[model samples]
Target: MSTLVSKVLVGSAMAVVSLFASIDINNASADELMTLNGIGKGKAEAIVAYRKNHCFKNANDLSSVKGIGSKIVEKNRKEITVGECKK
Candidate 1:
């Protein structure tokens, strides 16, 4: 690719990454959870459902949700949290 094109691509990737905010698993809405890499509508809903019954103490606790494994948790660890969501 041309230098300009490459730069644009890299910049776009960085912009996308920057859009992801830290999410609180215990109180995040499905839409909020969907912002994470690897979490789609289904997984996001599952997270909300799981949270209804269990509280996530840390990022690793995300693995308790069906379909959410350690890999998904690890991938989103930097953007996941267990505290209350900021309004």
Candidate 2:
């Protein structure tokens, strides 16, 4: 039973790590965006919307969103990628 529990825990952690490994804001879908901490469906949609309307110059551009402050950006920076598209 303990081994089963440990395996489950490790599997869950690995899944989360893999999820994070593939989260690139430049290309993430709404579902993927929602997986990020502090980002709900609305914010995820907003991010997609923002990406459509304007280019993300860098991680800093996330701050332009009404609710995405620097702290949030800082926390999720590793999960995001601005790509070569920038100001």
Candidate 3:
């Protein structure tokens, strides 16, 4: 039982780590962006729109979007990255 619990905990941790590692802000779709902390449909759409005209260099760049603030960016900082914009 203890060994099973350990495996479950490790599996959950790896899932979380992989999820964070894959959320690239520069190229994520609205649906994908919505997975971040505090992001909803509207904010995700706004992110997509803002991204269309601008390039994100870092997670902090998300604070420039109309509805997104520094707090939101900070919440997802470890879960976000700035990858090449999908063209």
Sort the candidates on lDDT, descending order. Answer: 3, 1, 2
Q: How do the residues 23-60 of candidate 2 rate in per-residue lDDT, one tens digit apiece?
A: 66766789888877798988989988888777777888
Worst 10 residues of 2 by lDDT: 78-87
Kindly report which residue stretches of model 3 are placed more than 4 angstroms away from their true locations once superposed: 1-21
Best by lDDT: 3
Q: Compared to the true structure, candidate 2 yields what TM-score?
A: 0.71
- Model 1 Cα lDDT, one tens digit per residue, 1-87: 899999999999998876876888888889989989999999999988887777788898889899999999988888887896333
lDDT of 3: 0.89
Cα distance off (Å), candidate 2, residue 13: 7.6
Model 1 TM-score, 2 decimals: 0.73
Candidate 1: worst-modelled 10 consecutive residues by lDDT:
78-87
Q: TM-score-based ranking, best first?
A: 3, 1, 2
Global lDDT of each candidate: 0.86, 0.80, 0.89
Q: Which 10-residue span in candidate 3 carries the lowest summed lDDT?
A: 16-25
